[model samples]
Target: MADWQGVSEFVAVAETASFTKAAQRLGTSTAHVSRQVSLLEDRLDTRLLFRTTRRVSLTDEGDTYFQHCRLLLDGLREAESALTQLKESPRGQIKLTAPVTYGEQMIMPIILDFMIQYPDVEIDVDLTNNQLDLIDSGCDFAIRLGRLANSSLVCKRLATRKLIVCGSPTYLATNGTPHTLSELGQHNCLRGQHDYWRFREDGRERNIRISGSLRCNSGIALLDAAKQGSGLIQLPDYYLQTALDEGSVVRVLNNYQDLEEGIWALFPHRRLQPLRVKMLVAFLTDALTNKVL
Candidate 1:
């Protein structure tokens, strides 16, 4: 009989090159991971790792063993996922990431609802504006907005969002509305993380470098500033929707508004996604497409 006792521990250590990180990934103590890897090496009668105070590295034999072990472990996970699908219930921990504001405003509600629907499922969500490397973070997927850089990850467009440039009526009255693309240079354009605003000119996408007194990363703060007649603002439709409807702000430069950009779900390349991930993606697609967001 093949004893599979420390294979996972050894693989984790090899992949992370740190017993501490492996232990963190496995939800165990560093001592336990070290002991398991030591036992694994004893059972195989081979040294698989070179450990120094600064770093850990795999031996040539360990590298060969890891290639096979990684594939085997992947197969094992797929088998378990397949079996779970047979039960007709998605159950497992799903780790994902999304933009902070949008995740809080839109994704979090849907996620909470999903949790209610599937009590067996677990979720760990990281909300940030920065694009995290899904593989390094061990996240199953990411929710990304606007233009995506070319990458090997699989992308599914869940929805589309229009960028609206608008300001409070008072601001428009005081500073004058920008009727042409060039006129935008004359007004105070509230800035976000980027110094540029996107538009469509002559049926082509254009980015205009904008400057303003306030430069903030928070959409809500910029929205408030616009409502208070601080300056013109460009933001996603969701952020400006309520204000636009309530007469707190009005759209300007409509002729130059950019076409809607995609809200995408990005996942690492894999032959088969776990059922839970598929379900969550489906749920998000439905919600966003139905204009629930």
Candidate 2:
């Protein structure tokens, strides 16, 4: 307590540039404030301020110390505020957006469970493939999959999903498995929204353009095509996991598979997020990390 005795008073004096004003703001006597500040400078063995009859100014060392102390003080205040918020139930609406299929398959279920637990909280979910501006659309946060583009939004990684390139066992038996990246040319490769598939070759990333008899934007439809032995299909693990486990589809080019993509919750920069938003983000993080969603 002795070490901390005059720090607040000194900071107040530095900010107000008046011992009397600092005392007034702190609800303490001017002589007490001056005495504390004097004791602080004596303890630190440095002159922190240049006192004048009309005004006060900080020394060079004092200015640097003040900057660090200001940050510490802010962190302390935020901690107190967070504690206060924790004592109250999170009651408000959380507006969020995510990719259409993932939102339906993974995120929505967890959100529904959260809503059940917190009856006072309301959620507005917008599922779309298009990347909407969170600030413009008035969303608190968004769920993004795959490789994210460089942006100013703050991100929290929730999980990761692998992209798999697979074909039905019957198709591979007849068409022959691809042994090398170049062999992909001779084989029919199913295309989704993009005509290319991402891969990592020899420690570098590559996008290989492919073509086949069928082209569809729906992952479910493409998974069906691969099941019926239409051709090779590349999709996320969520779509191909069940088929792969059931032996209906066989993964190929494991060595060339791209690194697992991130599952992230992104938010616009704000000084302090509301308790509800923080709670929802925490809930989603735990659920996704545990694979409960």
TM-score, model 1 to reference: 0.75
Would you give me the overall lDDT of model 1? 0.89
- Give the clash count for model 2: 0
**What TM-score would each prediction reach against the true structure?**
0.75, 0.70
Q: What's the TM for model 2?
A: 0.70
Cα lDDT of model 1 by residue, 162-221, tens digit: 899999999999989889989988989999989999999999989999999999988999
* Candidate 2 pairs with clashing backbones: none
Q: Which candidate is the best by lDDT?
A: 1
Per-residue lDDT value at 69 in model 1: 85
